[model samples]
Target chain A: MKKKNDWPFILPAIFVVAVMTQVPFLLTVVYSTLRWNLARPDMPIVFSGIDNYLFFLKIPDFTVVPEFYSIVLQTIIVTVVALVICTVIGFLFSILLDHPIPGVNIARTLIMGPFFVMSTVTGVIWKTTILNTTFGWYGVLAKSIGLAPVDLLSYYPLPVIIFLFCWQWIPFFVLIILAGLQGISGELVDSMRIDGLNWWQSTFRVKLPLIMNHIRVAVMLGLVFIVKEFGLILVTTAGGPGTRSYTLPYQVYMQIFSASNVGRAGALATMTVVLTLLAVNFVSKSMKKNNL
Target chain B: MRANQTLSLQRTAQIKKVIKMVALTVTIYTLAILYFSPILYMLISGFKTEYQAVSPSFVFTPTFETYKSVLSDPSLYGYLGNSIFQVLASSVLCLLLGLPAAFALAFGNFRKKGTRDKIYMWFLTTILLPPVAVLIPLYTWFHAWQLNTTPLGLLMAYVGFHVPIVVWMLYSFFADVPTEIMEASEMDGCTRFQQMMHIAVPLVRTGIISACLLVAVFIWNEFFLGFNLTGNDTATLPVYMSRFREQQGMFIAQLSASSTIAILPAIVVGWMTQKSLVKGLTLGAVKG
Candidate 1:
């Protein structure tokens, strides 16, 4: 009777989660093996068996490579670069905001404002108001200095996207890391001061090691979200200027919606999941090594 | 002569400390303002007229004219209502499903020694699965059933994706509840539901509130699944904001106003959850 009670308590949640997430994911894996296209209804759906995966993975010509490879590379570049910057800069911001200055909460609140705003909004606001060529702040500032404004979204899509990713996500890093900083006991801080350790020594040698786990948590969560970011790229570049800014998620969107190839999209989606897990595993392993 | 020299040195030191404090305050405030200028400018631009927003000037004549125009558009209300409905409904559903499971995992008996940990780990891993993994199948199913024509389909997806998060956060909160109290309640012949409602819920009320708010914020801002899975009538605020992308810097004031409306609630709710969010996230992830 005691054991039976546990299943009843947990069954509803387990059932809903499985049906919603786990089951669909498994179906996606199955769909990757079939040849199905939404647009071509005349052709019957049949087993393709890894053809869809090969569509993205196969390298017939080594000279140029495929768009799939580039998209994957771009995704890696954006996620990795953004995450590195978010951690470093977010730590700096946390340290700055962690000071016991008056009205500090207001400053912290201001920094956090971007994280809560929807990504689509962030994309549009930056593109139109800040980065626009003729009508934006970038354009106006360049004109005042007698320099022509280069369209950043077109010219440097990856860097621009990385910058925006850092801007939006760094606050989240700060939020987690700042909490870790505050969790340090007052006695520890007093001892650091009493030892007459300079600012750099105290910050890098002592405080950083203590907050390693917090940084790990922030980075891991940041990785999961950043790797799959779609809305920002969509509203900003729309993976345009010849698919230079396309991330994995955006490519998956294109595969399904634009190409109307269900099987290929499924395959891409599955690869994306695999890559995410690998990155996550790599990060956790590295952080653990660092912790020791 | 020694006393006079010491007094003079102490006064100078006090003066130097005051100077340093003032310098630090100024520096911190300046950086904060600079960092936040983009959103600040957006908020200000919402008050400007279209022509006034044409340039990047900060000084502007404030007006309700742009806001009034944006708010009166009928389509805006459709997306807003959908967002509100999704946030409210999905948050409630997630809590109802997650609370019991978290309670069971934290305190209930399982036949196997590791069953509880296994189930909890399963939920945690599910949180790591990107939405794209499930997108294809759910899209096909929703399309076949024409589920996108109504808001129910998206709400169900939101609830599904978010229930894990709720459970993940609340599991830690439930674990913090003293088992002795629960055991005492059980000895008094109280049902599991009675103990949960009377003891567990009250003890972790803040956690529940934060989880609900966090889920609400996520559902509100969710774009990938929301965009792919929903139709025109069922689309949410993020979709509405995406439509402004093709405007090419035109309609600056109107765009600002609408986005302000779309983003305000999430930001407000997000602010409220910041305290508990850190606690829940760090506790849950670190322990695992």
Candidate 2:
């Protein structure tokens, strides 16, 4: 069989990806080593020889590095909490709905609504309508009870933000895990039941083991998502309360756009990319080994 | 003796059933309220007038004044049009560039499989890199190329950022398509381009459509790129909303109305392609 080498067919996309994505990425790396600002057009690009990185390390208010670290911590917290809660809830629901349940499809549809909402819209809704200290619905409810309304934005922003994130993402985790659960064979479950294994043992030892890969993949994907997230943080808290809620991506945003420090921002961005790569790679490899 | 054993088993089953029912009911009620409350708030606020928006009352006379204002605003329409055009352009451009590359990577025989794999990994790495990392350099390049503040510039950035993921997705779908189909197409004297357009394209049409829809939503909802890249002429809905918030402050009930409008297209697309959307979200799973 004569297979034609289709470089002609492939060249356009390769060129497009290389020129647009790869070239820009390389330029970013190059620019990270140089001193230049958008505001000063005449400033010659001076090769600073790790000065950008050294400055980031030395400066107190170069909050990008510490801020990125804090963001990573916040991402870990939010992702793990959300993933665990959503997985448990999702698994329980899937098991319940596996049996004959009334209005199951309707319940499913309502549950899936959050997954469809744009992240920005979700952020806006939470910030203005629900969690806003002044005109928010929660505030009204508190006022109606003749109690001093709690300031969610100031007092406990992280937990409140985590709660909102979990609320939006739990439905997604539920849907995916439910789909995985649905794919499990019934005969295997029945056999396990016949062996006098209680529902708890059957779920933990049997069903969960079988669906562990799917769960891992879902959790890892969720981690990537939560880590890369910016819109919610931007809209809801804007990393307020003295940068308490700042995540890596938003930190990068602040450094580049707000502080006009592109080199430091580039270093932060590079570090984030490296961290995410390592995390994702570790997760997938571990899952593969365990599955084997 | 057998009757006694059967009765006890039946009783145990009945108790289990009751417990499961109770557990499910409590879970459903709690989750439903948690998930729906914010959305309900948004919908309700969309109907409130400017005066009522700031009032700390859940119970208020509903009004369509916000929606009316949003619809009547000329800038709102212009922003919406810009968003629509930009999203459509980005989606089409991503598909055009990504599909063939995905085909080559997934189906074609390359001498350097390792290199191809590296390219694939490099693409995935882009998703992790903060968009800000490239913003300054890309902005400078845009100015140098006279591409700044243009819809085409925004579209190019959108396509550049998104094509990798689209390729990653379509690669999996293309891999799933049996090699026999391509073999058969080749046997019929069809060129590689013909094989792709006539054979592979149709085979992965579902994947293509899903990728396009997902990319469209991302592009439409994109803020950083559009906000930084476009001025008034090419500003997207997100940029418009941000400006509205900054300019009008609390007086703008129209921001909520505009937000609801901005999200409508994505919501509709998501509803139509719920299964595909889920599959797209979990693309890594099915492949590995």
Candidate 3:
């Protein structure tokens, strides 16, 4: 048999992807090492070594932590908390949703609604329509009970952002996890039931392990997405209240667009990518170990 | 007497089961509705006057005034058109570029061992690369080439980013196609193109539809690139939604109406893709 050349079929995708993603990413790494500033265009673009990275990494005073560290911490907290909540609640929701009940499809569809909505829209809606202390449901409910409504977005930005993240993402987790649950063979389920396995044993001991692969997929994909979410933070808190809610991506956006410091922005962007890949790798490794 | 007692016990157990089912159903519905209430309220709020939406009360005379006014705004059309164009154009382009690549990755033979896995993994890693990592270069390039002024620049970025997703999804879908059929067809003198177009595609028809829908939902909701890359005229609906941040408590009805227009398609498309989304995503990763 004549060997057909695969390059013809694959070249276009590789070319486009390389030009758009790979080459640009390489450029970003290069940019990270330069002293380019869009604001100070008069200054010549020159190699600056690791100064751009050190700007974020270095600490001038031991007592006063830099904003970058806090931002990274906040990002970690938000992503980790949101993922944890989404997994726990989403697993419960999936179990409830997997039952053979009439009109369950409608319920499932309703729960899946927010995952599809744009992050910006999610931010604006939840912020103004739900979280607004003056005219939101939270406000009305609070006032009806003779309690004052505190501004959650400003006062508790991380938790609010984390909550919203979980809300938007739990459906996704459920979607995948439920599919995993349903994919389990009926004979296995029947056998477990016949063996006098109670609800807890069946769910945690058997079903959970059976669906660990699905959970891992959900977590991995969710982490990849949620780690870099900028729109929600931009629209909700705008990384305000003293940079309390800023994530790495939001910080990167501010660095380039607001500060016009291209070098620092590139450095930050590179670090963000590194951190994301690290987190992903770590999660996959740990999950694999646990699954074993 | 023993038989009668057992029948009564069985009837009581059946009643208990019925009660449990009813309770579980109610809980599920309640949770679903509550989980969905924020979006539901926004949808319902779209039907109210600004004054009616001011107080967040569920009870009010619903009106289409807000929707009508929102639809009549000239500025909204630009962003809407851009979003629609980006979604349609990018989805088609992604399919065109991705289908062949995914087909080749699934079935094509490479010179080196593990080349196929390496390429596929390369595509997967690209999915993990957030838009910010490529934003700076793309931004500068777009500016230098004067591509930001036109829709094509953003469209190119969208296609570049999304093609991997399409490749990722369609690769899995194409994997489901039996290699024996392709081999047999090759023996029958059917070309690679014919085998892909006629055999593999039709076999994974649902996969193709779901992948397209999934990508459409993603590009529609994408904000990071859309927010930064486009100029005012070229901005998409996400940009429009972000602008609503300044409205605060004012114009609640208009905000709701506009957001409804923005998110409705994605929600519908997302729902459509739900069944196959897990299959496409997990089947490929879980097995390997």
Best candidate according to lDDT: 1
State the TM-score of the second chain for every model.
0.97, 0.87, 0.98
DockQ: which is higher, 2 or 3?
Answer: 3
Reference-based TM-score of each model: 0.98, 0.88, 0.99
Error of 1 at B103 (Å): 1.2
Please state the i-RMS of candidate 2. Answer: 3.1
Candidate 2 docks at the CAPRI level of acceptable
lDDT of 1 by residue, B97-135 (tens): 999999989888888889999999999999999999999
Off by more than 4 A, model 3: none
How does model 1 fare in lDDT?
Answer: 0.93
Off by over 4 Å in 2: A41-43, A59-100, A287-292, B1-26, B51-62, B112-122, B143-146, B243-255, B281-286
Cα lDDT of model 2 by residue, B200-275, tens digit: 9998899999989988877887777777777787888777655432231364355567777877787678666667
For model 1 the local lDDT of residue B169 reads 97
DockQ of 2: 0.42
TM-score between candidate 2 and the true structure:
0.88
10 residues in a row with least lDDT, candidate 3 chain B: B139-148
Selected candidate, larger lDDT, 1 vs 2: 1
Better of 1 and 2 by TM-score: 1
